[model samples]
Target: MPPGSPSHPALTPRRSPLLTLVAALVIVEALILVGAAVYLLHGLLVEDAAAPIAAIAMVVMALIFAVGVGFCGWGLLHRATWARSPVVVWQLLELAAGIPAFSGGSPWVGVVLVVPAVVVLVGLFVPSVSAQVSR
Candidate 1:
């Protein structure tokens, strides 16, 4: 709203929900990594290939999450509008993945994963945040 500052012509978009979603997902994944490490210890071990594969997967996932969160947050804060869907899909997929495991495992897993998952999904659907994505 500054005078003579060359307005964007379009209204500034808001994507904080998406950015927040990414942060929550990152936290959930950190917990997952800890849980997996616990399982890998104390004779709850998986097979040979499984250990290496899990390690690689964790490393890659951490990198992916870092980049995705950075990009989504930057886009959201700057009103870039185009960063919404990828973040949405990413979080949804992680949520979906936690479901079956939750049913088979302890209750806390689902509780941890679902809360933020729902928040992020629902938050993105709201009028203000939804408007950013629609663009």
Candidate 2:
């Protein structure tokens, strides 16, 4: 088909595999945050938690962050260009948090946190993934 024709591949952008992977990773991260928020809420409501107010605040913040990340992942799935930077920023922040977990005597926690961050970070930059989102 002609380059600018309706039948042209470029005219109908397909989601690349790497982009799908990135979106899935981001969504999973958001879900994990939501789970953490639920845990905080449970502790605040059902357990003798320290500083209940702080725990409530933490739960609120976690839920907000989870919603934001979930939206970003949805945007990425739809190939929205604006979603890319926020997702990248999130992965950077995740890496920052994950690295500290290692020295905090939680190597497994560090690995769980770091692996997806690294995967999404690399996937976002992959040529196919980058091009897909840019469209």
Candidate 3:
């Protein structure tokens, strides 16, 4: 088939394994955020949150970030170069949040939050992944 043909494998650049890993991690993070948003919404609707307004605000924020991060993951799958920066920013924020979890006596929570952020950050910077996204 010609290079431009729909069936041609070369029509889309191949995603490197590291790139795929980063994308998958980002998607997982987005899904988790969505879950968090739902939990916050539940609190606002059913439970007696001390600060209902604050809970509502948090739910909105989580939903927005979840959508943004989800799109970033989709962009990565499609090789959109613009997706990389937001993912990097998200990982940084995750690290910041994760580090505090350790000090709060929830070391397991810290590990859960920190590990994937670190992995995605490292994967994004790998030579192969860098090259892949640049195209």
Give the higher-TM-score candidate: 1 or 2: 2
Tens-digit lDDT track of model 3 for 15-113: 798888899999999999999999889888898899988998999999999999999999988778999999999999999999999999999989989
Task: Name the regions of candidate 2 deviating beyond 4 angstroms.
Answer: 1-10
What is the C-alpha lDDT profile of model 1 across 44-123, one tens digit per residue?
A: 24545547666666656656565665566556555556766765776687588667767787668777667666776777
TM-score of each model, paired residue for residue: 0.61, 0.90, 0.90
In model 2, how large is the Cα lDDT of residue 65? 97
Worst 10 residues of 1 by lDDT: 41-50
Spell out the clash pairs found in candidate 1.
Answer: none
Candidate 3: misplaced stretches above 4 Å? 1-8
In candidate 1, which residue ranges exceed 4 Å CA deviation? Answer: 5-50
lDDT of 2 by residue, 47-79 (tens): 999899899999999999999999999999988
